[model samples]
Target: MDHHEGLRETYAGEWQGLTNSEIRARYPEEYEAWSRGEPVRRGGGELATEVADRAVPVVLDAVDKLPDNGTVVVVSHGGTIRTMIGRLLDMEPAQWERFGGLSNCCWSVMGQGARGWRLLEHNAGTLPQPVIGDET
Candidate 1:
């Protein structure tokens, strides 16, 4: 997810870390189109969509290995979390872009059930709500 190309780091020769305007000024049309679905052929870099594809399988593989009715906690970045949610909801890759971008220290709980993966609660932080026990 975040560690993947798009979010990881830009590797374009002379274009890395530059703003879009700077890239356009330096790299011309190729960089300008970077935001509008431009594919970073081979060594350039990967698009955000590509990163999600690489992340989904890793998450699913871990889930599959868990015992039925088992719970697992995934501590990761916003991109990784959103991508996982999109996969759980059976969303298309395009739709994955629309997943809620949760904040830091936030989490979403999903469950595997007869109806397949179901989203329980979204962005639940470590709060005392919905619980009776607390440090006395």
Candidate 2:
């Protein structure tokens, strides 16, 4: 149960922890660019790809440490989780928005398949049964 600092939430720079309204008021252009899926670094912070770059390595490291059939649970912020999932699935940064918002107290699951990593579930409320792997 160790903490991994790389799993922290997306660093939004000046927009860190700001609400939507607050961000629109203070950084309207940046917010609009993000809303339009233009890949703007909100508050001049890390881009989505950058967030994935930092977070995915931590996730992969945990997976590498697991014994055969072992499970690793990751608890992280929504934006970081989403970006990491997108990278694992090999989705382009432009496609990250296709992954929906993760509501409070929800979680997502990913599984390693023979092909690669696959999303088992997303934004789920209940604790999930661990996916040993997807051999098929």
Best prediction by TM-score = 2
> How many angstroms is residue 134 displaced in model 1 relative to the true structure, after the best TM-score fit?
26
Please give the range of 10 consecutive residues that has the lowest summed lDDT in model 1. 1-10
Candidate 1 residue lDDT tens string, 6-36: 2232234555568867776766767545545
Q: What's the lDDT for residue 15 in model 2? A: 91
lDDT of 2 at 71: 90
Best model per lDDT: 2
What is the lDDT of every predicted structure here?
0.60, 0.89
Pairs with backbone N, CA or C atoms under 3 Å apart (clashes), candidate 2: none
Model 1 residue runs over 4 Å out of place are: 1-44, 126-136
**CA lDDT of 78 in candidate 1?**
73
